[model samples]
Target: MSVNPTPLKPSQIPQEAFDWYDAYAHGAMDRRTFMKKLGTLVAVGYSMTALTSALLPNYALAEQVSFNDPEIIASYEEFASPDGHGKGRGYLVKPTKEIAAFPAVLVIHENRGLNPYVKDVARRLAKAGYLAFAPDALFPVGGYPGNDDAGRALQRELDREKIQQDFVAAARHLKAHALSTGKLGAVGFCFGGYMVNYLAAIDSDLLDAGVPFYGTPAAESLRKNIKAPLLVQLGELDERVNASWPEYEQDLKRYKVDYQMHMYKNAHHGFHNDSTSRYDQANADLAWERTLAFFAKHLT
Candidate 1:
């Protein structure tokens, strides 16, 4: 008696090669096992590659010379603190090949610390032909507390004063860098965002433009010293922080600061972060576009 071939489910096909396979094909394990294993490995490898690419999008661009590209070149450097007690460390991203001075952006990382995401952002800025510097605010305090139970523990012990000092020092370092365009701008997310706003208000001479996404400050009086153009991104769905944003915007308007505010509907606090559950791709993309545009218009 002749036996029918065993049918294979569509789910059985590896995701990587599913597009190339015939959906109707059915067979026993022995017939397709080799191909299946190969497909599975390929699928796994591809997934890992894509994930890695997303995390380190700037790797290739960082090392190459691309004037038209927006990926920034990353280099680590140490800056002497203004107080003269210790040295502050920061990562700088700049155009690989450029003759004249280029616009510079100072990026501040979130509470999670100076991770790959921040570096990628600096790379992005460099790719866009801007010199981007991301200083380690938590350096003096011993580094950032990544997102986890341990992170919370570190947050409680973070030294706010030292962070502020480090930020100021980082700005000074960027200004003195030979490749810097001298026209400096600042951008930060979450904790970094808060510091950006604070820095704008405190050190107006160091920045020509500032973009703060979902950052909070201890005092609004800092707004009086702001001398740069500001773009603030807010998420309406962020219940914890949304309440105070109105007041912050009002303060800016009240002070007659050159600023723009954007509120994304249904977005959360960490909407700009693609790696988090709170990430909202649509809003994040929009925010990035707005950020680059703002920097170009103001800094360049």
Candidate 2:
């Protein structure tokens, strides 16, 4: 009879492993390199599968708000991106309760594309009474392959500039939709967080509010162009992303941008993501509570 190895707790995983997974998740490192590095853990009686299971996202855990929820309606919609990949599609969700018009929010996904977690995020937003749209940057390349590893590999092949344009186009489409009240907010994670920063930087009037979780800050030169209210969320241990915050914060202050930042103690990169081991529930809940309040104060 074959025996299964014990499942490792998130606390058992070393911080180095989490950092390596973050790099691998963002396409900064390839799978072979990531696996080789994890081999060190395997040598210590941990099975390869055990280490991966501890680090990788289990999408099954992502559906906090189900697609069939009676309170919201969800579907995929396409929009034109003349300057981008020419076209794009997004998962759009809206509350079922009737209203003359609803405030809209653009939810952006990480480098791994529009995985289940992001879709569920849109649903959660809708449940809160905001129309939410999450565009798939990987759509132009064939969309998310149902697995993050494949999704990340596919996303790395697309043109970065065009992808930015696609997101901009999606924002415009959501704002202009007949059901929209013309108010728009944006929230993103990792690469998506970077996009939220980029969108706010390039088109000051485009977003009414912006929330970026553990995303890279925009170039200092572009900081002067930002006009939207921003709520920046960072993890205390995310050295790679936090390194740029000091200079970015200085520039935001110099320009007098409306923004606030929260650094969760002892949290690591991707801490807001509940589907992975890096998730920090206490911090994530507090950050999200602040995010919803921030959007309500500005968008409503």
Candidate 3:
């Protein structure tokens, strides 16, 4: 008889493992170093595969809302991005009931390209009766490449300025979409979150509202020009990202930017990403509820 190894629970993992995983996921640590460190951290009985399985995102868990859900319609669409990669593509979703117009939002992905988790977020927004678009930053380089490590490497090769312009193009395209009511909002995680802040700063009139989940703020020069209301979410234990918060908050207040920030206790970086062991279900739920309400108040 063959025996299967029981899946390790999150509680069994050490905080250092989660921290290292975060660094690895964000591209701060190379795969070789991460694996070597991970080998040392994992318990003796557990295999490297088991440790990695627990650390990396399982896209299967990302499907909170189904792709075939009856309430929403989803598709891939291409849009112009002359200033970016010359062109861009995205996953667009909208309510199936068909209204004359709908409020639109741009869903931004992490350092990796537009993965299933981001696409699912678009569906969730559509199911809530809003038009949502999540663009693939890697489209010009052959899309997501079916895995995060490759996706990250591809993203790193592109000109960051052009990529930023790609997102700017995506925001413009979605806001002016035929089905859009011209009320535009944006929500992004990690790198996407940073993009939200960047968009709000550079193009003051672009976004009516913005939500950045554990992302770094834009440059001070750009941030001073922000016009949109913002909902900033952060994890208390995300020391690397949180280190910039005090200075960022000072600027927000000095400039009188319409913004509110929430730091979830006991949560780590990527806390809202349910696909990984760092996810805090309670914190994620509360943050999402707050995000939806914030959008409703501002986007509508």
Candidate 4:
């Protein structure tokens, strides 16, 4: 008989740690307060290093992700956003293997501008057979400051309307790329998820579909204008985001929109990022598989 090993449960960390992380990811808290708050997780039989290392490996382990996938072509590129708010810079990735006009996806980051994790996400999308472009919202003001606090501060300074223009331009650039088919799609998290809804609503002719993870819902006014299908992923433990789902679903139904949504049980916001222990691998894997299937059906 084969034996199944028990799942690893992070017992030492407190739920409060995840709350602090949520606050940080959404730009609602500064690093000093976040760290001071998250530090409490170590009080229950865990060392500060051990628990921090587990909850947030990205802050430290990011350098190790020189994801040199031989099958992927990945690099940074700048594209024109003349009609947009300003020029855009993004981490671009595509499969090196011959592809006749591959489907393209715009990978949007969390509140923090284009960071290493989002770049890696672009590479993963490429490995999965789609062209992925992740734009940095702070490109006009230099770029993403390497530090978290600086990135969050820069995030607040952004003009919401102008930022939308940048994303519209970025998606257009991806769909228009020499190697891309006319089909265009997007996947965004948190801040980016909200962007996906906004962009899809306004550019019904351009955006084909969207997958938004823990992003705030589209307003009722915007729902009527949405042109693409939406695959929404929510974390059951995230009260701030979950509160909008009931009304959002009603709006989707009222508008007769094509959409699908799932709330991962016992999961918190940002569950898909493996760089953190907060990631629920089982749920994230299922969500990712479903997301890929959804994209293949709509984008391809």
Candidate 5:
């Protein structure tokens, strides 16, 4: 009979010290130099990647998986109004393993449209045991202008009424889905984030929690109509929106709405989108943790 290998024990090694020997063995460092430098840092107790991975295997796996995993099934459902003028909408839906009715989240993509990044976010939410739906906000513009410059140009030409109708249709469709627990929340990035805020202002039935990352504020009249709690994320280094965040907070306070506003230092717009140059891993991770907690508090 073959013998199974013995599992490593944390007590066998110092947790705080970087494992230079392991690094060298894994090819992250050369053997001779790592051995020479290892002794110098042993006394100070430095943390190492190997040590952390060994201690928390789950953390390592979480970091390795992209927020949007393509393998996760995202069934697209299309809808159009009776007038034939409304642009059909597509939503990314991922179910959870939990048997009981679980809370659902609607994820809105940035100006890039309902691309891979948005799908990845939905997958992450599903992995966390929540039903996630990512709707294409740009369906009115022929779906994601493909390039940033062109997308913005198309955004300028979009009709607000058309987009609003699309959102409404998408919401109705998702609310009726079997996976939805009737407790719902919304999250959006960049342009999508702004639209989430807009939806909150208008729709009072389905929204329990809202998270808008670096999105623009809605009109004061609309803000007063929002019935859900909000957790808004902003980036201090994002010149485009950081300066205006104070005004947005003031509006939220003016309406006496339950809200939490966070500004990540040294981060920029699109920090949640890893495909973009403005992505900020630290801030995105923090935002995601907070978002899940918020949904759990309000929806669960």
Candidate 6:
């Protein structure tokens, strides 16, 4: 139940930790390399196991909800992508009793496709009464391999535009589902977060709201085209993602797109994902609460 490295004030963290996190997140450093680099922190008091444990999600944390949870109705469902992209499948989560038409939310994963963590995210959404669909970007290639690294490998090989189409198609299907009220929203992390920007930029008629967590902004030219309201969340310590924010804010303001941005202090990249050490539970929880409120305001 302990968070690895234990929670520390941002000022108390060592420089090596930030280096390792940046390298690992950018793929310049693999798990092994990250561990080797992080070893330095062990000398400073944290155990090697604790350090590693804090960064990657253990099985238990990766899935906080179960399929048999009293109100959960979960299953696999397929949707058609664009002609060339063919079809895709996603883990669908909904409430067991559907009293009326419910707004749907599309959960987009990071570079690793839809893994257990993302599935748990969808289930959490279902608990809030939304029909949640988490589409696997690896689907057209055979779906998530059940391993994060394996899924990342598959995700890297995808046709960029076609992958975008797959998401668009999934949104279309979710919006058309029998129990849907026709209002659709999206929440994406990392790569998926960037996709949220793309979705807002391109799918004006279908997507009504977007919440992109630490994602790259859509191209400036596309900013003016966005019709949905956006709630952008970022970690103050995430340099790579932060680098783009200044210019992105100018575009958002210049374009007049309805949007709100929040940057959490003392947080690094991927702060909202509880499966990793970067999980700033306090900040993550607040961001999530706001996200749900934002989605409710627009989707309902």
My TM-score estimates for the predictions, one after another, are: 0.73, 0.97, 0.97, 0.89, 0.71, 0.90
lDDT of predicted model 5: 0.67
Better of 4 and 6 by lDDT: 6
Q: Which ten residues in a row have the lowest lDDT in candidate 2?
A: 2-11
What is candidate 6's lDDT per residue for 1-300, written digit by digit as tens?
965455454345575687576677667788788877787788778677755555555546766678789987999999887543889999999888748778999999998778888899999999888999999989888888887777777877888788888998898899999878899999999898999999898767878999999999887777778888999999988888989999988988887889999999978888888776677889999999999999999998
In model 5, the clashing pairs are 67-120, 68-120
After superposing candidate 5 on the true structure, give the runs of residues whose Cα lies further than 4 Å from its correct spot: 1-72, 80-87, 96-100, 140-142, 145-150
Candidate 4 lDDT, 1-300, residue by residue in tens:
955433334444577777777776676776788777756654554466655566654654333335687888888888888766558999988888876778999999887788777787788888889988999998888889886557878878888778788988898889899988978889998888888877777767878889999888755677788869999998888888888888888888887889999999988888887767777889988998988999999998
List candidate 1 segments past 4 Å from native: 1-72, 141-152
TM-score of candidate 1 to 2 decimals: 0.73
Q: Tens digit of lDDT per residue, candidate 5, span 1-300?
A: 955434334343452223443233224555467645645544465333333333322312223335445434456767664432364666555653547556778888765456666766777787776777876666666876555435545655666576666666666666666777888888988777887788788877758889998888877677778889999998876655566678888988887889999989866556676653345688889998999999999988
lDDT of 2 by residue, 1-300 (tens): 977768777678888898898788877788999999999978887789888887999988878899999999999999999999999999989999978778999999999899999998999999999999999999988898899888888887888889999999999999998878999999999999999999999888899999999999776787799999899999999999999899889888988999999999999999988888888899999999999999999999
TM-score of candidate 4 against the unseen true structure: 0.89
lDDT score for residue 176 of model 2: 95
Cα-based lDDT at residue 298, candidate 6:
95
What is the RMSD, in Å, between candidate 5 and the native fold over all Cα?
12.6
Please, what are the lDDT tens digits per residue for candidate 3 over residues 160-244?
Answer: 9999999999999999999999999999999999999999999988999999999999998897899899999999889889998
> Candidates ranked by TM-score, best first?
2, 3, 6, 4, 1, 5
Provide C-alpha RMSD values for all models, in order. Answer: 12.5, 1.2, 1.3, 5.0, 12.6, 3.1
Worst 10 residues of 5 by lDDT: 55-64
The residue pairs found clashing in candidate 3 are none
